[model samples]
Target: NYFSKNPVTGKKVDWYTDFYYPLLNQWAERVRMVTSPDKLIFVEPVPNEFCPTSLAEHQPANMVFAPHWYDLNALFAKAFGDFTVNVQGLSRGMFPLKTFYWGHKGARENYTLQIRNIVEKAHDSLGERPVLLGECGVPMDMNKGEAFETGDFKWQARMMDALITALEQSLIGFTLWNYNPANDDERGDDWNGENFSWFSRGRALPPSLLYYEQDAPSLDNGGRILQSIVRPYAAKTAGIPIHFQYEMNTGTFTYTWVNSTPNPASQTYLKGEKSVFKPPRTGHPALMSLETELFLPSQLAHGRTVIVKGLDPGDKHRYDESRQTLFIVCQDASLDKVHSIVVSLDPPLAPAFAVNDFWGDFGGTITSILVAIAAIVTYFFLL
Candidate 1:
């Protein structure tokens, strides 16, 4: 609509020939005189000066750049510069923020270009330090005054994909705006109902959607789903590092180590010495270190290694949902056996297979059984 203009008919052609060309030539000349070929310089403030707590909380990621608030920009004009703090809006939520479904309207494209320019200038001024365009997303819903639009789901995602692609070159990372979908209203209508969450209200996650939440396990009790172990059969040599990670589908469990025999098989079997380990509470991954000597059983003549894992019980609903896998690099040739150690990787509680294979096998078996029963019942009734 904004692109519309009158058709070039007889009178209009004359007007264009006279007025438009001369005006365009004059504007071009003026632009050339004012604008330089050199790029604009943009300086970014040091990261922590804006929000001390947030900077402390955000973990290091390979591909992302987090930005400070608008006011903090002046502090970091020079590299490694210290800043005077001006704190605002730091504590608990002051009531709730209104959800405005301001749809993308006039000048949206122009606005995007303006933001792009700012990012470019900032990167040029700061010298490249993983310069990413952070915080530039419209809500799914908006108020009347806000120039944002709520389009179909596919379209929004597609548009975001395009924007992210454009940003990829200069930006090392991107942080999507506030993830908390709760705008303080149960109905969601107060905030246009659309800007809240990736999830829809009411419908609990279906079984089919479980996979996305399963892969990353939480070290703490909010716990992750117990991902199934598709391949049960595993082999381990002695002692490189016994790698094991757990998922708390049914809350967290304490890990205990036992050694049954003296050989490889015995290493898998926690037969005699019982040792339980309660892993520390952590949101981020923490390396575990437990040092103790093991008793070697003579029958197999090999030594035994031990490991333990534990999770808190409070996080049951989501934590108790999955399985854990233990892997070892085989440090000791004398000890080859690795079993599901209340903490071992071998001899998992359920059968273990590759993720894809496990899914296929589980689905196929269920389908086949149902079909067989249906056919048998039909034949009997017909007879």
Candidate 2:
């Protein structure tokens, strides 16, 4: 009866009556016969007007209207809960063609709004069945340049955003549009002539860098190896030195000793397992004692510490670095220990040590004389 009046394949018949039911039957039958361990079928009613209009016009012969997707989700609990729902297909047309097929804003908006309206209808019809934007992407290659918005990368991003946004506000899963890479895929092309799919032997261009840069998922590389560390020296005290030790999980780090009090000589262990040490650099509290060192292979796997030592008064220190792993030792005036140790993989500084700053101060004869005199006095007195 239905076919005599409406030819199944004819352009005159509504696609929903002529094609939709046949396709739905095939899908349901396959799901039933495949009979895999975890395979099953759960059908629901979703209405859309723009597509063939068979289901849209008939209204499933039993269902009524309801709220949009987001409002339906609110029933589960506030804040649009998560869910997975199946979307049939675009109301009309195929992949690349669909993107450009609609000529006016009203048509495009109407199509998009139909999807939004269906989300609400489904929520109301089935009482919110885990809404997901099952499918709403397109396969774009280099050929259909005219079909795309100026064939520009930004257009792809915008299209993706629009398609994604059209789904339920609380959508969970989103399967991209038809992806058949074997059809002569071209990164910038629009069709199958040059591999119409995304995958290819050469570099595959994505919709756009801006899309991933803004919305793609990201991961943390374990928050840099080290956090923060400090080492202080005694101000007016007699022989008290300070040291520190840091515990870290990353591969590298920087060691620093903030020596407000001055020391004649302060030693930082270039390499050490545990305990204390004293070296030759000294400065005030604000001045820091720093050492940037890489961990030996044996020491890299687990945890370790570095020691800082105050050979004599007048030593201020701090240290830092941006490496995979590090162990630092600085003398602490507060502790009786000879040195302090911090283990990490953080950078000691931002600008890093410039050659000009590291060696520029070693000026002339006056500097040499001062160093020599200071060395002599420190050796005689501290010894």
Candidate 3:
């Protein structure tokens, strides 16, 4: 379908090789001519197309391979199931039946494998450039808009979690599909019956109060599937990141990275800071003193315990409450050693007493007091 007839020779020509690739190279050149060297150019892949080796020949410096992926079954059916298709291998003439996944675990594994495959292919074809998942998200109005009527977005949350977990496992950055203020339940994004926005004007309220007007103001507004969207991540690292994962059910987050010595050349001039510094000795590995920062959401960190491993003695970790950031001063003796940080919910000391339990106990105490007062009043009246 992508083959084009050569106008001069009246013969079929490979569109990607003869036309699309040249156009892409020319476009990149034009962009580089106008933009600064530091500005990164994101090259998008053609639909179902991998990063062709031809592109690597003309690959520009500071360029990123940005591709989009989605669960085609969920996108088209407006629902999520235990099955998913292997959309990545389709371009390679791989059989879809051979790539299909069946159970819940299989579906989740498929997402991870697909994303990892993209990253690997990008490295192979485009060198060591960063591969960003340009777009990824789920349709909010899945299952015939049942979540909108019930005010329960568990399905949406699960789908979003699975997608993000895959991205984390693949260790690639991503910009979620959308965040449109004009999105409503009925019209969606106002395009093609699609609803991918994280924020929606239409409230996901129960059917009983779907149209009910409120006299007083409400604090809860907008934001859908926030539990999955708002998550903890390594905002900045002093070294190379090895791996990171978050368990939504357990509110556990773990991140590991190799400790790296601070580069004096990269430091900016600040008040009262040294302008010149001596380089580290060549014979020994330089000790890392830079801080590795992680963005830990306060909501998740409220009752969680943070554990830092591979830190030198006397080196301490700090959590800035206002910024919701966990900073670790990694001073590992060896640069080859990996440092790890874990934040997990603390185990309960006793049986858990939830908000419902508190309310139930309060109600029971009030009822007992009222009965005692009534009995005393009756005794006085009889006397």
* TM-scores for every candidate against the unseen true structure: 0.24, 0.29, 0.74
RMSD in angstroms between candidate 2 and the native structure over all alpha carbons:
28.1
lDDT (C-alpha, whole model) for all candidates = 0.30, 0.33, 0.70
Candidate 1 Cα lDDT to native: 0.30
lDDT of each residue in 1-383, candidate 1, tens digit only: 21243355423333333443445445545554687423232222343233222222222222133453221222122111111112122222332232111122111232233334444444333322344444544333323312123223332332233333323322223554434423322343244353433333222343444444544322112111112111121122122222222321211122222222223322333322211121111121222322222221111111222233342232111111123333332122222223223333222233222212223436688889999999999999999
Clash total of candidate 3: 0
For each candidate in turn, give its C-alpha RMSD to the true structure in angstroms.
Answer: 24.3, 28.1, 16.3
For model 3, residues 318-379, the per-residue Cα lDDT tens digits are 88756888888766545445677676656512211121222354668888999999999999
| Model 3 local distance difference test score | 0.70
What is the TM-score ranking, best to worst?
3, 2, 1
lDDT, candidate 1, at 288? 35
User: Using lDDT as the measure, which candidate wins?
Assistant: 3
Q: Tell me the deviation in Å of residue 161 in model 2.
A: 2.4
Candidate with more favorable, higher TM-score: 1 or 2: 2
